[model samples]
Structure formats: C-alpha cells, structure tokens
Target: MVTGPAPTAARRSVEEVRERVAAVPDPELPVIGLGDLGVVRSVATGADGVIEVEITPTYLGCPGMAAITSAVRDVLTACGHPDGRVRQVLSPPWTTDRITPEGRRTLLAHGIAPPVSPAPDGPVAVEVGGVPCPHCGSRATRPHSPFGPSRCQSMLWCTACREPFPHLTAL
Candidate 1:
C-alpha cells in the first residue's frame, strides 16, 4: 500500500486522514467504501498526532460495526497514522438516505438492491412497494422476508427473474 508521509511535530490534517479512511471498505458491503456509504462521519487529528474517526452504524445493533472500526484503524495505521481511534456516534442515527448515488449504483451492480430514498420529512417503513429488482431491473419484486443475512438488509424475491436478492433496509 502507498503510505502517506509520517506525521511531523504538528498533527496531520483532517483531510489527509479522511482521504485514507474514506478508502476503507465497509466490512459487510465490500463493494462500497465507508465514505460512499456515508458512515465515516468525520476524521480529526489531535496535537499528539493521533487520528480519530467517527462513524455511525447503519443499525443500532449492527454486527459489522466492530469489523468496520478495526478496518478503519488498520487502514489509518497502514497509511502511517498509527494509534488511530474509531468512535461510534449514535446521536444522529444513520439512515439509508446517507448512501451516495454512486454507492447505490455500486450496490445494484453487485446484485444487492439499494434502499429506496426515504421521504425528506422523516423515516418511513420499507413496505412492499415498487422496489425494482437489481438483477433484472424489473419492478415485479416482493419482500420474501423482513430480515436478511444482515440486520440492515431484507430478503427480496424478483417475480420476473425468479431470483432472491438482499435489499438494503431503508431506515
């Protein structure tokens, strides 16, 4: 891996740390980077040169949060920022709306149905609606189960394609 310059007497810049942390992929969704998923909330470097990365989990009990934290630390350390800290902030809960447009396209390309954008007013239930199938791009898709392999996803079956896929739950 290409490493950045070691931190000098002064702390490294936030943008420098963010650039490296942004490249770290989500443990559950490898196709999407933490930045693209809008999970890496902020990156800051202290006067002592320690970097802190704040992230928000997609769900309250998301199992991947631990892995994502470790991955962020590992990436920062590899990039010459050792002893990096990963903080999980729960104040502003994460929402599917945070996922970027490019991330949504990447999810669809990876055969995972991206979550539909929630109403701007507030959160909405992800009921059986007009969620298009990722594989066939058909609107004839139905929810097979409320739960999926992961807490943030739901099992969906495409009627036209006769295939089952995981749909990211909109929160």
Candidate 2:
C-alpha cells in the first residue's frame, strides 16, 4: 500500500490504461513485461468509471500472482485510477503458446531457453535428443531436473557449454 497524497485522476483512454498496465514487469521474470509474457488478458473501464485489468496466471497456483496483482494495483493508483482493480481470469488457462515472440527473445537473451510453442490442440512435444541451449544455441542440452524454481520452468544443462539454465516449459 503506497501511502502518499492521492494522485489526481486523469482522463485516459482505455488503450492508454492498457498500455500502462501492460508495461508492468513480471515480478519473477523482470526481463519480460506482463503483456509480452501474455498474462495481461485485457484492460477496460467499467461503466462505473473503475479501471479493470484482467490477467491469467501462467500456472494454477503460481506464487507470483500476489506480487503481480500488487504491482498492477500500485501502477493503477499511481496513475490516478484509484478505483482500478485486478481480476484473475482463469478460463482458457494460460499456455506457453501465449508467450509473445518478443518474450521468447527476451528470455533467451537472459539465458533462459523459451519453451517451444505447443500445437493448437495439444501440449508441446517432448524433445527427443535435447532442447536448445540459450548460452550456446546448441541442441545438446539435457534436462537437469524436471522441476525448476517455478512450475512453468525446468532446469537444463547444456552439454556444449556446460552451463545450466532454466527452460520455460510449455503448458
């Protein structure tokens, strides 16, 4: 809770509000914005003049949701939309495929191999040999562990570079 003088309300369009909210960074993965991460489902203004931001969680029990929600609320309040509220929309659950191309590039640049997008009707196919290594861009990476710091990621070790990195798993 930010405790300061209340910001003056400004008349911003829905798109403006959406852009401001979408620009918020993912708390866990600061390299990607919520929009690029595909968590920001929608932003709109209600008839009551309250701003509504809808987001989908990457996983059902993602630990970062609280932080994300807090960040959204803070941003809204700072921008003068004190009535703004965040809504968690779980329908049509989030999948790795929702990650934007820019998000993938950002992850790779940050030494995390982005998950291969899954098929429209199915989950991602398991890599037969190994997944690509973000460090060396080699396909000689093996899974160090199926579990990672987060539910949507796995630890991988690159044989080519002998480096360990996280891979965003396809949901």
Candidate 3:
C-alpha cells in the first residue's frame, strides 16, 4: 500500500482538509459520504498544525460511530495529515433535516426511502405516515416495523408496490 507523505511544517490548507474529510464515506452506508449524511459537522486546522474534525452521530449509542471515526482518521493519515483528530459533537444533536437533497436522492436510488420530516408544530412519532416507496415511488405505505436491521431505519411496506422497504427515521 502507498504511504502518506511525511509530516511537514505546513500541510494541506484547512479547506482542503475539510473537503477530504467530508468525502469520507459512511461505513454502514457506503453510497453516502459523511458530509452528505450530515454527520460531519466541521473541520479545521489549528495554528499548531493539527487538523480537527467534528462529527455528530445519527443518534446516541450508534454502533457505527467507531467505524466512522476510524474511517475519518484513515482518510487524514492517507492524505498526509497523521496528526488529525476526530471528535464527537453532540451539542446540536444531529437531525435528518441536515441530510442534503442529493443524499436523499442517493438513498432512494439504492432502495432505501429517504426520511420524511415530521410535523414542525409538535412532537411526532418516528414512523412518519405516507413514506414513499423507493421501489415503486408510491406513498401508500405502512410501517412494517419500528426498527429495521439497524437502529436508524424502520421497515415500511408499500401497498401500491406490495414491497417492503427501509425508511431512515427522522430524528
């Protein structure tokens, strides 16, 4: 395997570091980059020449955190920024609203229904009604289960397509 360049007094610019880290793919969802998934909150290079990356978990206790963190670090090292550090930022807990429109489209293309935002007025259940089916693009869907293979997703069944699909829950 090719190794990263040796550490130097000046490394890549802050923006470059940010862009590289942002492109890191989600371990669980390889099709979506961390930036598109809304997990990578920020990236900055300190005066001391250390690159710091902040990320938020899709939810607390997400098992994928370890893998995501590892991937970020790997990217930094591969890009010749071995001194980079990854931190978790929970202050402004992550929400599905942060997912970009492109990310949503990617999810649908890969057979997963993008999350549907809950009502803005008040608290809502995790399983939002009328979730469209990725397979058939029909809104006549019902909750198959509150939980899918992963904690971040819920199973949904489309009446129109008569197929089951996974819906990323809106948190």
Candidate 4:
C-alpha cells in the first residue's frame, strides 16, 4: 500500500484516487469506465506525491490505450499528482476478470453483457455467454463477425431486436 500526502492537504486518498480513476469513463466506450472496462490495473502513491499506476490494453492495437493513459494522468493530476506516471504492464495482459463486480453491473446496464467469470489473463479461447438483445432482452443473439467493434468484442445481431451489438468474445 503506497501512501500519498495527507488527505487534508491533498484532498484525496489513495483509494479516492483509485475511485476517481475508476470513475473516468473509457473514451471509446462511453458506457464503461476504465475500471469497468478493466483497463486500470493498480494505483499507488509515495510519501511525497509520487504516484504511479499500472494498466494494460484490452487489445494490442486497441485505439483506446492512449486515451486511457491520458485519463489516468488527468485524474491523478487533478487529484494533486500532476507529475505522476502511468505505466503500461502488458506481460500477463488484461482479462475480463479484472472487471470489478460493479463494472460487470455497468456493462450489463449498458446493454453489453458481462464476460464469464475467472476469465484467463491472456488471449485464450474461453466460452462467452450469448448477449441479450439490448432492445428486447433476448438471448437469441448470433455473431455477425468474429471481430466486431474491437478485437475483444464480436459483432452480434439479436434475433429479437434485429440489431447489432458488441459482445465480449470468449477469452
């Protein structure tokens, strides 16, 4: 656990910093915050305001990587760690399991289904649940494209809604 400047002086605790970072929505998927999207891996701070965060991209070439970095920096800066550095940790890679329980709720609320539990940490085949139609809330959805809006998502059309939605592909 890294400690930052006193909460009275800095107006934010490490947990608060994390909460702020988690609250910043992903620029690409406005419906999901970075935390909800499982982009923020960790947050820590030193005694003298030396803050650092670890994050990994959902996909190798995901366009939102830069945006997530910027959001992390912006939130820390606003919270009094203007010089903080955000590090990208890609070794183990990111998995849907990192998605917080609240994040899963957010995904479901946004009409995007949550991924299966205990997902693998790297690119590996995992079973994905059928996406419910955002319009009609039906499970009769089929993949339109293995690769959809992004590498992590599959383009699917709901037989009930007859509309395309992004479903998190199997791990």
| Candidate that scores best on TM-score | 2
lDDT per residue as tens, model 2, 20-126: 87889987788889999999999988888788999999988889999999999887877778788899999999988888999999999998899886557876677
In model 1, what are the clashing residue pairs, if there are any? Answer: none
The total of clashing pairs for model 2 equals 0
* Best candidate, lDDT: 2
Distance from true location, Cα of 100 in model 3, Å? 0.7
lDDT of 1 at 156: 92
What lDDT score goes with residue 55 in model 4?
Answer: 86
The lDDT ranking, best first, is 2, 3, 1, 4
- Candidates ranked, most accurate by TM-score first: 2, 3, 1, 4
lDDT of each: 0.84, 0.87, 0.86, 0.77
Per-residue lDDT of model 3, residues 14-68, tens digit only: 7877787778888777788899999999898767868889999999998999999
TM-score quality measure for candidate 2: 0.87
Model 1: worst 10 consecutive residues (lDDT sum):
5-14
Query: lDDT score, residue 44, model 1?
Result: 82
Q: Tens-digit lDDT track for model 4 on 20-122?
A: 8888887766788887777888888766768888888887888888888888888887887778889999879887777778877776677666666753476
TM-score of each: 0.81, 0.87, 0.85, 0.77
Q: Which portions of model 2 show Cα errors greater than 4 Å?
A: 1-9, 119-128
